[model samples]
Target: QDVFPSKGGSGTGASATRTDPVHELTPELRRARERLLPVIESLPGPIDWAVAYGSGVIHQANAAPSSPLQSPPMTDFLLSTPSPTQFHTSNIRSNPSHYPLYARLLGGSAVAWLQDRWGAGIWYVSMVRVHDLEVKYGVISTERLKRDLEEWETLYVAGRLHKPVLPLLTPPPLLPSLHANLLSALSLSLLLLPPRFTEHTLYITIAGLSYSGDPRMSVPGAENPDKVKNIVAGPGNLRGFRRLYGGLLDRIPGVRWEDGKVAEKGWIGFNGGDGGEGEDGEGWIVQPSSPAYLADLIPSLAPRLREGIAAHYRAAPPNDFGSGRGTEAGAGAGAGAGGTRRPYGSPVYHDIAFWERVVKDPQFRTVVRQELRKIMYRPALTQSVKGLFTAGLTKSVRYSLAKIGKWWKARQARSAV
Candidate 1:
């Protein structure tokens, strides 16, 4: 049996040998993929990953058109490449009109620089029409995307992956960290949520994570107030959520499904095989109260998040401190040469007492929320500002005004009631 069924693209020396895996899409999702294939394959040579996600691709009921005059939502894509400069060069050469006049004037090197050196390490090319379909896409280097996933360096790409997406191509190299990103989201959601929550609640929390502390989300005309609820409200989207995360939930220990197991077998996940045994119903998942059990949760978090939690404990100096190799007296503690703090790097799971205090504190959830805000807020706002430039003023205004219209309508409806 072939380990990787297809080696896509005539990659340059670096991308020549790829072990791209196959995805089993649902009928609706498969059609989405089929519609997007031409656009995907037509892109500049090799890409690390290609995925379609957003309200457009998932089609939530609340986001549907209210009148015949409404245009279909543009399908959004996130593409990862080994080399952004090379990819941009090829893309701009082929699709010069896709970018704004200013971006086109800047050239590929400048565009890639703005992307890599700027907020959240992504570059956008929006509102392109291809193959009779309206499309918008963003590009980030594979390494940067992997860091965002594994390190939570920025939740930009990582957050988008939390919800359902139609992945056109996800090669072996990016799968592990991508799965780690999902696992981290679950661990955080379970940590923050009540001891018992329905599957809908879990999905809702995960979907809203990227939006938490997002400055744009606070602005009335910037986003859909019900975006998170709408994301997971419909049956189609709920099924998409199951396909994305059910496998991981099934493998977690000590979680009891109250109604029905959401994960069905044979969904492609981190293991690249079936999701193992699972049932077919939306259910309430119960998490245990054990601090020891909770400590395991902390370890799987992205390093940045894990460090934040650990720093909080160290600062407060729990009674159980110094049990697992105390910092020397007058030592820099966990600080580096420049007086910046880094992770203490000790295995945290062994510090059961530390976790006991962490989990038991009434403020634990609050601390996690604040830490998430620190990780998420700035990048989201900065990226939104960046989008204004990348998407061009006309498109940006059109997008913002559309959202404002939606916001106004929703507010007026509430007022009338």
Candidate 2:
């Protein structure tokens, strides 16, 4: 009979024999794997073995119609052992020269730099550890990968990953060490604004300013205001700003702020409405008259705006600006029960609102959304599966399963004998 084994019944020997153990490896894939093998072999610790998996292991002579081969086949390495830390440390120590490349590939150096600069070194490293591995090994779904890649590309364009080695990777690292200050300023701006207006143009403007260090910070009139204006208002400036804003916002959580007086004020500020002053009351007058206000209109405001922008770029810590869960009551109390009932009215809030308006502008929105869509669905875009695994490395999972099958086959042979 062609019947399969029932639940509690032993399957025929065919079932066991049908399982295949070996996987074919292509020449290019084999070469890539070989290159990484030495790196893995040098890893210290009690690792029993290492292997490659996925398309790297599939071994195809030519690219399928669906997946064209533009570059060398990428391979993901899985080191089998009990301790992950020891393995990772050994892996890095085994090849320090390659560590920068790994950092570049995994998007960790920017994270590390931000953490160190912002006094949140521990949190930044922790985020790097979590996100880098996940991004490296295809641990996330395709949709999520698209989102992350979009954000990374934005950061790259904004000059966030200006450090060495990062540009070598296809997508490049999000928020590199050199551009942490710019990223931080952009983050602060996002925190200050509503979600809808947060666009790439605003963030890029901030990034450009930070890079130039306008000197308007400690020294008034130290730099040319025209230069700053040129950078912020030049052609394609808006697009750059949008990416910077989007990238920064992606890193923050619960970005949606409550609608109220502060939200309204923030909205007005964002909409270029002179922040609701109308020549009366103490509101954030967009077109200010005071010398300080004129100085601040760009320069003074730039520094304050940068504070919030930078905070957002750095992935605002839970306790930052009293943003943690428990601090809600305290923040509310500090704002006073009857005091305007606004969203966190810090300078960052104002900057965020301004950028949000720029992003939401119909013309700007249409262009950016189109660009983002194009980036999202680009057919030739290649992501490294090796760098995509966070929760579990694919190679490790396949290797374990293969070993189990091999062991089972040996046991079946012994029983038959």
Candidate 3:
């Protein structure tokens, strides 16, 4: 499949040219990768990519002075493979201990089915001892991962990629999709955010997208309540966010950073929209990056998307949108310039003329939140159910207990404060 599939964009004004991001390992990330070298090497052949992520791996952006001193080493990894069936087949044979007895008996076909078809399209093994370290890892198909990245189909792995990662075995082919994922996160976050906000706020929004409607987050002690803040609060974490998204922010149309308030040492600010220099603003602009972003992101709410597209398309005149239909022909055809007149109910995915107007709907953000909940809620619940089998009841219990304990500690700490 093409790495960065085109979304049928009409490149008009400054075409926010984007490319694959280069991930240079920090000292901590380098150490972490080196630690996981054995596991990386031992994995089955033809693995598309593998990366080490999670709290134990790195400082997680810029850590504020007030933040906790050190995090326990986390050995969380995501492996993207072309053939999950083959990969699982080999893994089950090599490390039968990784899966429960039922999973092994069900065979690779069944396990792969669950991973692809169920809960956010991922299968994870927890509390795994790789060499001297206890590691947890998730497996996903390259296609499924790509879909989540490009289509926001699940926002599972895509949300994880929104933050920086330690690339143990990344290849060039996957870069475009990775960068596009970040851009998508940015586009959605800008839509959800207030007119003006801090860079921390932007990163927070991006980081929280996956968990927004996720039951794992809502249930008491299932997840750390401060998970979002922890991921985004520190200067180290903020710095990571900056490295991943700073250049992309510049590429976004009608966005500019505030005066000197944007600091390289982990501080960033920008005014809302293309507003003038001296107005009450947090710093960055929140416009819909581009027509393509607006066009591409509307699919979650397809009916609304179609309605918006059709309405926007019909409102414009023929010549106005380069529809090629003269005034009279367009009226007769009931199509807008640059838009094909579909029957009463046809999906209009890529009409630039329509996106210009569709994004401006007063209820865009509110409706987006509703649609996103509809898209995310069920998968989040189902994935946790799948975890009982994928990770095994024992491992799931252990992991959940560990998470609950962590949440309790955080709650106590916050309460004491």
Best of the candidates, TM-score: 1
TM of each candidate vs. truth: 0.85, 0.21, 0.75
Question: Across residues 43-82, which tens digit of lDDT does each residue of candidate 3 receive?
Answer: 5534666777777664542222233774355478887777
On residues 228-345, what C-alpha lDDT tens digit does candidate 2 reach at each position?
A: 3344443333323332233333333333223324455433322222222221122321121222322222212223232322233223222223333323322322222323332334
lDDT of 1 by residue, 1-417 (tens): 222111243223232122322254566667877788678778874576778887778777556563688778878999887777788788889998878888788888888999898788898887888887788889888888889999898889999888877777666656678789988998898888887887678888999888896898889889777778777874477666766676677677877665442343343322222443233324567878787777768877887877666666556544544544433321232332223465536544335555666676677888888888888888888888898888888888887887898778767756777
Question: lDDT for each of the candidates?
Answer: 0.72, 0.30, 0.64
Candidate 3 overall lDDT versus native: 0.64
For every candidate in turn, the CA RMSD to the true structure comes to: 4.5, 23.2, 8.9
Once fitted onto the true fold, the runs of candidate 1 whose alpha carbons sit more than 4 angstroms away are 1-22, 65-68, 259-282, 318-340, 343-345, 348-353, 412-417
User: Once model 3 is optimally superposed onto the true structure by TM-score, how far is the C-alpha of residue 10 displaced, in angstroms?
Assistant: 32
Better of 1 and 2 by lDDT: 1
Give the lDDT ranking, best first: 1, 3, 2
Pick by lDDT: which candidate is best?
1
Rate residue 115 of model 1 by lDDT.
89
Order the numbered candidates by TM-score, best leading.
1, 3, 2
Inter-residue clash pairs, candidate 1: none
- Please report, as a residue range, the 10-residue window in candidate 3 with the lowest summed lDDT: 4-13
